[model samples]
Target chain A: MPYVKIELTREGVTREQKQILIKGITDLITETLNKDPHLTHIAIQEIDLDNWGYAGEQVSVLREKGITADKK
Target chain B: MPYVKIELTREGVTREQKQILIKGITDLITETLNKDPHLTHIAIQEIDLDNWGYAGEQVSVLREKGITADKK
Candidate 1:
């Protein structure tokens, strides 16, 4: 069994998106590792900007400065 | 900052329990990793028995068979 966790800023996330992410991650893991789909566990977590940081600066602060950009 | 994810079976979990878990994980990361509490991220996820497996058997099946047990 494999456990995976995906964490991102909580600006916008929908139930449908979460569903897709869970399925895609599961499929990727199963395909790559040859593990059973039912045995793969994927959890997606949205972190508030204030709780996420990069380079010793919180994401919220970087957002205010317009220096933190997400690619994709 | 470090991100920590805790995954476990979802049988009985309370909101209060989750709070304790979050705090404990964050504190541990902050202390051990020397990361700031405000920048540390901790997400706790509970997986359904049907989704988690061990030894090629789903946790639900093991539960039914009384072969899977959690310590503490």
Candidate 2:
């Protein structure tokens, strides 16, 4: 069984969107990875925009510069 | 970018194994998910065999019955 987890920082994600994400991920795992849906465990943790950073730059900083960090 | 994360419960995993897991996951995200390795963020949290449960059964219980949960 493959255990999948996600941590993301994004704005304007609703609960419905989260469900879609979960479904999409599950489908991807099953189709692309050839894993069993029931045996695959997945979890997603939402991080505030202010909480994520990369290359010494915060997500907000990147966004202000027109760089979008798309959630998968 | 798609954020990939993993949580696993297993025994006899060494530090080298953990590194391999990370590299494998990063490659999978880049190749299978078609995401940039730099943009794609991933994390793996190791859970003790006693800490994970499924279908009202612990990992140890399943393993004792000859059911192996393979790490992806």
**DockQ, all candidates in order:** 0.10, 0.23
The DockQ of predicted model 1 stands at 0.10
**Per-residue lDDT of A1-72 in model 1, one digit per residue for the tens?**
887767778877765566666667777777888998767666555689999988999999998998856675
Worst 10 residues of 1 chain B by lDDT: B50-59
Runs off by more than 4 Å, candidate 1:
B1-12, B15-72
- Write candidate 2's Cα lDDT for A1-72 as tens digits: 568876666566568766765676666545544445777767767777677887788888888898875424
Q: Chain A: TM-score in each candidate?
A: 0.84, 0.68
**Model 2, position A4: C-alpha lDDT score:** 83
Spell out the clash pairs found in candidate 1.
Answer: none
State the lDDT of candidate 1 residue by residue for B7-56, as single tens digits. Answer: 88788989999999998888877888888899988787786565454443
User: TM-score (0 to 1) of chain B, per candidate?
Assistant: 0.83, 0.63
Binned by DockQ into CAPRI classes (incorrect, acceptable, medium, high), candidate 1 is incorrect
Off by over 4 Å in 2: A14-16, A30-36, A70-72, B9-38, B43-58, B66-72
Q: What's the TM for chain B in candidate 2?
A: 0.63
